[model samples]
Target: MAPAARRTRPSPGPGAVGTGPAGEPVHPAEPVPFAARVVGWVLAVGGGIGALAAFVLTVEKINLIADPGYRPTCSINPILSCGSVMTTPQAEVFGFPNPLLGIAGFSVVTTIGVLVLAGARLPRWVWLGLQAGATFGVVFVHWLVYQSLYRIGALCPYCMVVWVVMIAIFWYVTLHNLHHRHLPVPGAAGRGVDALVRLHTVGLTVWFLVIVGLIGEAFWFYWRTLL
Candidate 1:
């Protein structure tokens, strides 16, 4: 019989599957989705705009607080009064204008958003940090709204912009955290929040509409009194 045919094996190319020295197979990296990229870009741009707006408003509030008569460049009317809101003790929750907090908080958020938009793959800890910051902002904005409506008896247009933007940022961050499983919420709570988000886009819209309606009603009452 002829000599046994010599055995031969093909070498692996760059695209081929390969084994490590320990004989473990290496897998390829997964691609990120186009929708996620678009969302990142949107968050970056929106966060930047919100941060700039908050910074300007904070500066105006500081000036108004320091000098009561200092007229802001954007003060258009008695109803649209930054000065009225800024002068209130409620504006100084910690003996300083609340917008200062917004300026600092939003600056961090804007930086994160920009990095994400630039294709940075943030770790879980970073996402958790964003969630914590956003939760605090949302709670703080609601507190301001309560003060504006009930205690201060005045509304600030710039303040409203901050409120709305903060709400948007909070919602966006919450959604992202849930989708990426970055939140530390426990089993039942996490499932519940996720269920609410997944099942109730319309409910979220309606909830927002109700908030706007309440604000609109308050504005209508204020306008009626002025008129």
Candidate 2:
């Protein structure tokens, strides 16, 4: 009689690679797409512009404090007056100039963008931190938009640049997170999120259009005269 043969364990499949060290199901690392690289560059440039604007506004705000009759360079017309907007109480939501927040926040954004552009892959926790920061920034920008349009009755050109860059940062970061499954969603939910991100430009376009409409409508009386 022949001796009984011993059986070896089968090799793990792709699905098995999804498991964590604790044998828990996890999302595997996905390849970074080319669009992400483009967004990274955008973030770097946009963040730089935003930071510069913030720095200028901060200095201008300080100058305004020293000279009550000072005029900011960005105060071009009645409708667009950084001096008027900066003098308002809304300019300092936290007992300090809001641009201070932009200065610090945008600096971090620019640094991360530079790293990404250099082909650096951020860890999951860092991506989560970025998502949180971007979320706060977008919300804060919208609040400022409302304050500028309805309450302050003036627009700051530099501030508007910050708004545009902030939106871009938030949108692209959110899309990156979704596409990479950084958020703790189920497999099916992740697929749905991926589908939504696939048409991200559509949603982003509509979002920009909506904000633009809001701005135009908020100053409809002035806009109608230009027509």
Pairs that clash in candidate 2 = none
C-alpha-based local distance difference test score of model 2: 0.88
Q: What RMSD, rounded to one decimal, does every model reach?
A: 5.9, 7.2
Candidate 1 regions off by >4 Å?
1-35, 65-67, 184-204, 223-227
Tens-digit lDDT track of model 1 for 1-227: 99999975545546647866665555566667333554565467656667777788878876876887899866777667777777777878897777778778877877887787787888889878888988988898888887777677667877787777787777777777776667656777877766756654565577578767867677786668777
Query: Lowest-scoring 10 consecutive residues by lDDT in candidate 2?
Result: 8-17
Alpha carbon lDDT of residue 144, candidate 2? 94
Can you give the lDDT of residue 45 in candidate 1? 66
TM-score of each: 0.74, 0.82
Candidate 1 local lDDT, residue 96? 75
